[model samples]
Target chain A: MDLRDKYGLLIDDMADMRATVRIQLADGGLEKCDQARNVKEAVQKLSLRRYDLIVCDYNLGQGADGQQLLELLRRRQILPLTTAFLIITGETSYEQVATAAEYAPDDYLLKPFTADALRTRLTRILEKKEALAPLYRHLGPKGDPVQALAVCDELLAQGSRYSLDILRHKGELLQTLNRSQEALALYEGVLQQRATPWATVGKARVLAAGGDDTAAKEQLAGALKAYPNYLAAYDSLAAILEKTDTEAAQAVMEQSLAVAPTTQRQRRVGALALENEDYVRAEEAFKRAVEKDRTGFFKSHDDYAGLARSYSAQGKVQEALATVKDMSQYFAASPALTARQAAVESQVYAKAGNAEAAKAALQKALQTRQGGDLDPATQLEIAQACFTSGSAEQAKDIIRNLAEDHHENDQVLAEAQKVFARAGLGDEGGVFLDATRKRMVKLNNDAVALAKAGELDQAIAMLTEAADRLRNNCQVAINAALALLMNIHRKGMDTSALARAHHYILQARHANPEHPRLEEVASFYRKVAPPGTLILDDE
Target chain B: MDTLLATVIHDAKNGLATLGAWLEQARAQTPSPALEEACRQAQRINTQLVELLALHRGSEGTLRLAIADHDLADFVDDLKAEWLAPPQSTITVSWPADAGRIGAWAFDAYQVKLVLLDVLRNALRHARTTVALRLAVEPGGGIRFTVQDDGPGFPVAHSATMHDQGSGLGLSFARLIAREHRTPNGKHGDIEMKNAPQGGALFSLILP
Candidate 1:
């Protein structure tokens, strides 16, 4: 709780306000303080050095606010859990800061607060952070949730003052580790004690993860009614509804936007509206997503792509092409952007009845892909272009490969289905994607069964080939590593097999760091590997 | 018209806040009773502007409370820190000792704090020597905050309306904010005002 040793960062656009706050912070016993005037400087300072506390003004004066900066830092993992972030805002922006869906600051102080008030908030947040430091040590991007769970148990047993916070983190960790039943119980127990929005949404998420979508939807609906400002409930409900009812999902997203108009939510609403074929609404939402952030840091390629498609759908092909051109100017040159622009151009041209020009653009997009792998979004855009340019087989091949590579990624698979839907093949796309999913699941099951039946050599041969080809398929990589480890356990330790197992485990981790089976495979490696070998620690 | 009113109130409130910050800085550099009073008045105007904006939103049916979990002890501590005693006065304020035991409750801390501060300031003006703020769990569920002063009770004729009080806007704003803190099970918070058996006015804000 001593502020003398803590390092603080003060961010504000106004020089006078910064000086005033700097004096107040000094009055609060914080001597080692740094200042940043904008998001760029703030991020630069944060990346270079770690601070114990950050006090940021809400209005940063450049189309960037503290909330957006916090989101960026949190998403990029530049801000650690140990650092306390506080937002200073006027009454006008308090609701926006309060209703932040994700990446909320530790606390916020309204403007016109005195030095004592500021110190009290800083002290309280610092004290809580100190209490939960042990758990946070293992809760970073590269940290181990398995070990973090152990810390949670220890803290709970000791009756820590932050029991509710610890419980929240524990439930999230349980869900991440795929322990749905236990997570369900934890949430239910918390709900019985008192009604909390997070507990309600957490229970619904567990139900959804366990494939009880009906119950999950019902729970989320009730939670939303109770806590209308709870953005997480709206997000979860919209995600569940997206698969069954795009219109309803779009409505839910609109309600959330009414509560808090985040650019990410705008993109989501645009995507859902596009799926619902409400082209005008899609264009408006995507336009907001593109133009709201004049800083150009938060806008993604998907925003422009969504805007272009919405325009094309409404027979505004010229506007769509113009939007694509603006996208290239907004962002620096990159292969992904080139591929995305060309692919979207193909779709626009096809919609305009220029089949020859569409085919030429599709060839350009395909040539760009030959240089290297693009992001999944760009790849799916190319697949959609393929379908529009009279290349059905090529489109199917592209989607099939992507589906196999990201077999366990629901978001990517959903994007693939959207591509098909845009291509006027919704029903066929669902069936085709379902088959690809089943095929991938069966491949893993058969390999595991063969290994269990003592056909280790056959399992190894089957799994390694699949794992090597589908590098992004986490399940395949995990199984391949498991088979090789099992072989070494039955036979003597073959150095080559051990090395390959290590490689596959690391590959699996790279594919999905939070995969439930990762820790299990890692522990298995630690147990079977010889001493003095280079062991991969779960840092 | 509503948008214009809200925008003007917001800008005025922000201007007052900056003025208050400057006053505070000046007071810190060169302490004086006049600077201190100016700072307090600036803060008072800022709070009133905030209340007016909330009232505007309430009338327009756009008043949304950003309710979330807040530790009761920290909330009380913050209130105590901000509740400055009137200049040249000797009235003292006391808070509940059991706030730490209550843990956290879900409410809009910013708005609730303003409501309580308004009530506390009013009580300070009317109290003879002391004001007390108490916190306890409501009978069925939820939490209650009570602010009572030791002075002449509310006038018998205006006990219900309290129109003799300044503007009567604070009471209405308090009631609106209380009613907004509702639960999923069709339960809503309420505000109650009555003369305490001991001496003075007693106000209870219950949140579910």
Candidate 2:
């Protein structure tokens, strides 16, 4: 709700809206209308009463804007499909956002519209919605997907007037279900009719999902060239760029942010710019991310940490330290996150001329590290801090732990090597790293031997222990997951064993999202679980 | 300069909305012709403001169309309901039954309404008794809208290009918008103004 003291325009706008709506309803022999001045009041009224139409002004002075409010309602399914939302905007810029948004209002009305214009638009939209009701029943915001597809086929069979609308909905639902080929055919049907940006972008997305990146990129380029402000096109295009070209990905991410500064998109922009070592842009983007995420929907503690890292990259040690403190205020202290924060503090202190403070911060980080299985990323972070603070011996232990667990990850191994090289222990590091790798290999092989001997429970126990030790090591974690899967197969799908398999798969998937072994694990999951069951990675 | 003009127009439009609301309240309470007239004038002010804003946007290239297929008969009836008040002036809309059963056509409904509303308001202002609007689908899939008033025709010696100083801007705005309503095939709409042989100002818009 708005806390703004200036209520003049708001009061006037409410009066106008009420009068116009009241009269229009009166003409149609209907009554019982109320006008709300802010988002909170509107939401409350909406919940308590069933209204056929809402003429919401885009700007609500503060808190959520009308688009955000509409998004929240639609996502939460608080607004029924029959409730027509007509967004009213004072500036044309809102149209860009409306066009870009995935869940837009029924229509947009420019401000200073007469009561007659409002009536005309309201009447037309109601009629249109009435005409599209059958499709809405099958494929609206809270529609049943299977029924929606069935209805789409039925509508197509009957040559329904809303054939194009149903076609787009069926395409999107099919895309969501990973049925890219069928979705592609539908999108192609739309493209045959018109070069609409949504259809163009959908074709690109389907192609990308089908692993035809070259064609996908060309389709995306066409979509972007046709409609520069197509937000989803920019995002899908950026995801493609992320795999092959970081700089271009940064550009596409920036363009998307220009249209809608979603926290997730801004975070991606910050991360991609940081990958390019564009520290200034990274800092700006992270700042925007942190600011926009203040009310916290898709926000996380990492956004603040990202800003601190950007500050540390720029040698703004004081700012970095303050940012970590700010992070503490937002996220409650936890053992693992406390260690990560201390590690960040250590990095900031090491950048300044405070060796003693840096050493103390390392002590704080290590004290927390004693409590839990530190993920390889946290280990690497703490190790970097240790090396920066003149404690190479302490840093070597964390690096060795990471190198042992992550030996199969080229990206992690390279990053670890750089840490060792920077600390002037390049020659000594190879011996330590090799010893750790050999030990981890032996441990893995011993578990396999136990399994081969039909000591399945022993094998599961050994891998469970290894999982705690390796934590964020994808290969080792996947092996642990495999052991659990074997137990599920031997024990006839016991609930406890299934839960363990599910847990390890989540950590493994998060550690390396695109792990090649995912196909193998997915096959095992299919054998052990029901068909159509959602897994962590799939979700 | 444009910004200042827009701000003034915005304020005027908003003020008219408020006045319209107050007039509606007054009419609901007392049901007087004077309050009804006030409401009508407020609506007229809003319509004029809208035309002026469109004229401004036309100067820039920012006035985008919101195209949709509208039933020609339904649209004409709605337009009549919107403009015609009781007993002051009468408006009648008709279409030929021989026009190949025209169901619907794609056009910017709001823009078309604004353009035609300006013409109808001008006709209402001058007509002695009745103004008529007719819709006809041309043989080539184009549509024609004709608005004629049974008022004193355009001053006898008035040239076509020279708009009457009073109704000049509204008619000009209507012409600008009619031309803007081009079909997807790139065929443009056209506007014509004349003094009908029956002695009244006639305006027609043809869209392809």
Candidate 3:
């Protein structure tokens, strides 16, 4: 209950972090606190007893993350209603968590926090948590979202000071219940009162999920203009752009990194440049990433491969060979890294006109990927190696499978197309490409035709089928999504349809780069979609 | 990091402030020859801190020096009064034996003060008896200041040079301060330390 009683918790993983926090907390008269190092420890401790305040880290190395742990505790009713949970994270990837709505913490804190700042944030969260306990208790575990929304609405209507937070919670709840349109409207209502960046980002999320990436980009861009140093906005904008404009995407990432350069962003930008064949930039970015975050768990032979590729491109064959050979000197014997080194070796050998050496290198890389513990990106890179080594047929199959599987994803589609084009399977690529285009068009027209003929069920059926078949096709996705939106609009004009249509439309635009209708449809989506579902303008 | 540098300067200044406080406290509590020596050591540290801060300011182009005209006789009189107040020391004034040459002149007041302070310190250190100062005008439209002490004179060839000195930065600092004034040939002003013909150390400043 008191600040002095909070620091005695036996959390080992973040002892340094705890010490730092303790120093600051001591300034605030807080001590004797309980702590959790990981999900298992946290859960085990929670099972025995409930702490008044639970300060948790989002990433716990392995198993359940902070959010997942929160969900588990909340779902099992092991966590006391009186206990407050605070999440901390180095990353700004809050939206990337698939079940974000399911395990929302009481409040989250960003890193590099000072004592005074942390104290201020914790004090506010404590105040709010106390105020909302009654409603939280009434809702209980496995609470009804509609009922929760009503409670939040009642609080907002009463003009509570916690209205913004309540509105956010309400929207998140709506998002969970698949009532994104209503949630979007609520978010927009909050935005109209003030230019809140998080609310704007929330709206962009709805737009992105509803399939309107252009709208999402626009919203994110607007937010970024106001909050240039806000890393989350840049990250969201970068995510949208990564599907279409690699150069613009890289620039946004670089800008973000310049403000608060992270190891992950550096690695991501480096890998993207490598894919784009901008080897020198990739190498430099990777080198900076390596030098900056020595403890980053995401380390790979990619840095070496990147440098190797850069050197090969620069016509320094010997240096390229030397760099790859030297990676083994420092790192442990990693088969995946060996594969990466082999891929680079093959490229170097091929550049040097040594076919036999290239083949041998390619075989080693193939062997590495076959060891079955490679990360997804590494697997993609290995697939790329296969294509580069004149195995077009094998590359075609790999890409086609990945494309069909992540068919609804714009970034994945672009990546798939790039791989196919790289393998010289342009005609086969065209068939898949043209078929996707024709199929999307037909699917859209079929759903529209079904809706116009007063066959609503058939229209819904047509859309559902289209959704299943060309899950990644933006046109079909948007059309099918639009049908559902129309259906929902007819049933009292709810905003959920708008959210869905927007998300699907964005996806479509991403899949078909330079599509003339992208901007037009996006503008239309903005008009019909719920206010919170509109992403900020890019330009 | 810029904040870190600022903090360092702040800490150093605070150290000097604390030393001053301790010196004052000691002066009241105990009076001994050894304690006087301790006080002088503390004063040296304080002076070093002041010079360091000035150097910092000079590097930043923020060191302020007011330029004004003052009679050489009045300037020497004011310095003599300050010297007489504390540890009294004998002083003598020498000129071209004429009044017209040792007239009023204008230069940076702070640099002039620093030059006089350095010469006075050197005089106090080595002059056991009397120190002499000479003021004159060069053949051109320039002014010259010369300080000579009655202690051992400096070595010939090396002592006349600018940078080569046992004290390291003080001589260089005096010369650097002198460069702010310009000569008639458009070169900056110059300062040099050497063995006076009579005895002891001699410091000279030539100003345009």
DockQ of each: 0.47, 0.10, 0.01
Better by DockQ, candidate 3 or 1? 1
Docking class of 3: incorrect
TM-score of chain A of each: 0.95, 0.62, 0.57
- TM-score of the second chain for every model: 0.91, 0.82, 0.74
Superposed by TM-score, candidate 2 places the C-alpha of residue B99 at a distance from the truth, in angstroms, of 15
Superposed model 1: Cα runs more than 4 Å off: A100-102, A210-215, A537-539, B14-39, B163-166
Q: Which stretches of candidate 2 lie over 4 Å from their true place?
A: A1-63, A74-102, A107-148, A210-229, A241-276, A292-302, A331-539, B1-5, B19-38, B51-88, B94-208
Judge candidate 2 at residue B195 and give its lDDT. 86
Best by TM-score: 1
lDDT per residue as tens, model 2, A1-539: 11111111111135566566556445543444566777667767777866667767777655567777787678656787766678778634443455456566777776656666666766666665676666677554334556667777887798655565567678887886578888998888765544355677788899998899999998888666545555778889988887678899999888877666777778889878877789898889889888876765546665776788799889898788888888767766677678888887887787777888888988999998888777666777789789889788889888877786687765577557656765677667766777777887887888889888888888888888888777767777787878888877877767777777878887777776555565477569777875455454455
Candidate 2 lDDT, B53-122, residue by residue in tens: 8788778754544444455655665565555554544554333333324545556666787788776766
Interface RMSD of 2: 6.6
lDDT of 3 by residue, A1-539 (tens): 34565533333366687677667667876766666677667767777765767777666664446666676677567877667677766412332332123345755555545565556556656666776765575344334455676788788788665555666677777776567788789878765443444677788888887889988888887766544455677778887887678788888888776655555678778867776778788878877866654433345666767667777776889988988897787678877777778877887887788878988988888777767545434555666767777786665555554554345455666655665665666567768755654555565677788898877667877776665555445556556656665676566455555556656775665555333335455555555555555562542
Q: Number of backbone collisions per candidate, in order?
A: 0, 0, 37
Please give the ranking of all candidate structures by DockQ, highest first, separated by commas.
1, 2, 3
